[model samples]
Target: MNKKEDSPSSLDLIWGVSEIAKMIGRTERQTYHMIQSGNLPMVKQVGERYVASRSKLIAFFIEDAA
Candidate 1:
């Protein structure tokens, strides 16, 4: 098997809007607004769900704290 097959999928690192909100302690609506307003990193939508990159979210918080 290849390393890619053994590793988790990219989707695994992608978080839903609600999950992102919980991580940042914000409301889902607020999170959506942030995304809409371009205040937050862009996400990839999968069906009805919005998926944000975990690394981007972490970097955003780290930068905010700086």
Candidate 2:
């Protein structure tokens, strides 16, 4: 299989709750709570899972920091 076909153009384009949690050094459960509280922006839905846009998430933190 071609590597490009197997993975995304950019790994950060879409991140699952576990990936986001790992990036922020938080647990998956905590990340879910943040999503439920509307603190974090949720991305497109793929089936039953919620993924987040990397750029949007970064922007969210940047705006939050301001």
- Give the alpha-carbon lDDT of every model: 0.78, 0.74
Which runs of model 2 end up more than 4 angstroms from their true locations? Answer: 1-12
Candidate 1 residue 64 C-alpha distance from true site, Å:
2.0
Which one is best on lDDT?
A: 1
Give lDDT tens digits, candidate 2, residues 1-66: 677656654555665788878766689999889878887855555687778867678788878889
Model 2 residue 44 distance off true place after TM-score fit, in angstroms: 3.7
Per-residue error for 11 in candidate 1, Å, reads 6.9
Instruction: Give a tens-digit lDDT track for model 1, residues 18-44.
Output: 898887789999988987888885576
Q: Lowest summed lDDT over 10 consecutive residues: which window, candidate 1? A: 5-14
Per model, state how many residue pairs clash.
0, 0
